[model samples]
Target: MIEVSKDGGLLTLTLNRPEKANALTAAMLADLEAALAGPPPAALILTGVGKVFSAGADLEEMQAGLGRNPAWERVSAAIAAMPCPTIAALNGTLAGGAMGLALACDMRLAVTGAKFFYPVMRLGFLPQPSDPARLAALIGPARAKMILLAGARIEAEEAQAWGLIERICAPEALMTNAQALMVDALAAKAGHIAAIKALIG
Candidate 1:
């Protein structure tokens, strides 16, 4: 499930199926895609409700053919296309296809103790098309290979050092830290934000 909240210029999208580690179902992916379908918000934060941000696609759903779903790419593409700043406020471990979402974000912040990995090699699936390039852009090509090929599970500290995540915060302070990063964007005009993002890109 996904929970959406709009606070003035900031829009927060939270993955809410904590009991299942927020494993994404087809419907959940559909909801996510729909949520980003309208005009882009001034700023957006993608986060999760429980200890784990997401365990990637739901196992049962994957077996039913969700693993190769185009929705994953669509959702990630939507996030990457947003003219406003987008943040992935990772609450815990990030694994599998979920890495695509975080990599698509303009920036990523994780809670201490969080782990990052993409086991597409071991799982016998290629990652969503754009994930590897986005990840490589953030952390470099070799390290991205370490994750996608060697299946290395990167700890939060290592992730920051390797440039995978921008910052690490205490679990309780994760959302606060994320909001802090959005303040400037939220205060700026949407067109101004877009112009700056374009310049940076």
Candidate 2:
């Protein structure tokens, strides 16, 4: 579900189920919430192994839960509200609710080969509107509409050009650069970072 490793102040969380395109399960989401809530790691990096960052929720598991459960909301909110700086390393394509998870992060950096898409409407679903405010803030409302409402998939280069991604790197460089960025973040004054985040939020 998730592989968590800590080195100094950096916490790296990897989505482990590549066989399923890293689609998140309920148990996996629970573990993710617990990991985020248990401690205040100086910085957090969320990524995925193999190809896909995440394909979104495990539809089978989600259907089993009937989409009415409160636990998912609680866990998602906890991740969104984590105190430390959080980065999403889009190691590959991201879709559906996984895009929501990426949106929860404070910043995003995608691999050169990565792609971003929001296809909830294709599934006869609606995205969590609050989750995309970060995307709109990073890009703009008009572009956000093109991406979200139009269900358009954008390549990493275009995303970077649009200011949706902080950086774009080759596949092998994604985690390395993300770690470097986290190191830089951890070196900054924590109070100042918190203040800036608060002011911006």
Candidate 3:
């Protein structure tokens, strides 16, 4: 479940599984890989269609299949490999593997009530490989340690202050403003954006 839309240079991928809190599934991961496996768009925006960004991996499916882990890892890698700037529009909560997806993006915008959560400590599961290092680089060792070690779920305001998100928008203006920001950020500088993104990554 992914809804793809393109307007000018921005390609938006919306996770469309509200029924399951937009949980990340193997098929969804496949779709995401396919979407990113192309010449880069000027900007890519990832968001959820419903109220929650993602509840995490499809636990029920994982119960039936142990193969979901590698696919999920690839999803995060695909997001990171995009040559152009990428943004995560956090309409609601992001849990578990969803954190890696958002962290892989170049920028992140979250609505006021949105949150960031990971259960690595509580669930005793190893996080995606790149996640701990990237998160620590963004927020610092102590704060990142607090989050991953204690399973903290920080809300939007605190998340922004701690470098988890770039900005917090009111619910109604989230997507519109996110798109506008992407357009403004990448206008007439697609090559430069790609160059800098490559350098950074």
lDDT of each: 0.94, 0.80, 0.84
TM-score of each: 0.98, 0.89, 0.92
**Candidate 1 segments exceeding 4 Å error:** none
lDDT per residue for candidate 1 within 24-129, as digits (tens), equals: 9999999999999998899999999999999998999899999889999999999999999999999999999998999999999999899998889998988889
lDDT of each residue in 1-201, candidate 3, tens digit only: 999888778889999999999988788888888888776788899999778999988887757653336866677788888777788999899888778889998889988888788887887677878889879988998898888998888988899999989999888999887888776646857778777767876
Q: Write the per-residue lDDT of candidate 2 for residues 1-201, one digit (tens) a residue.
A: 789998887888899999999988878887787788776777889999988899887889867862444555665576677667889999898887777778778888888788888876677766665556767977899888888788889998898899878888789999888888777668877776677778878
- For each candidate in turn, give its C-alpha RMSD to the true structure in angstroms: 0.7, 2.0, 1.7
Candidate 3 deviant stretches above 4 angstroms = 65-68, 199-201
**Which 10-residue span in candidate 1 carries the lowest summed lDDT?**
117-126
Clashes of each: 0, 0, 0
User: Which has the greatest TM-score?
Assistant: 1
TM-score of 1: 0.98
Runs in model 2 deviating more than 4 A are 65-72
lDDT of 3 at 40: 75
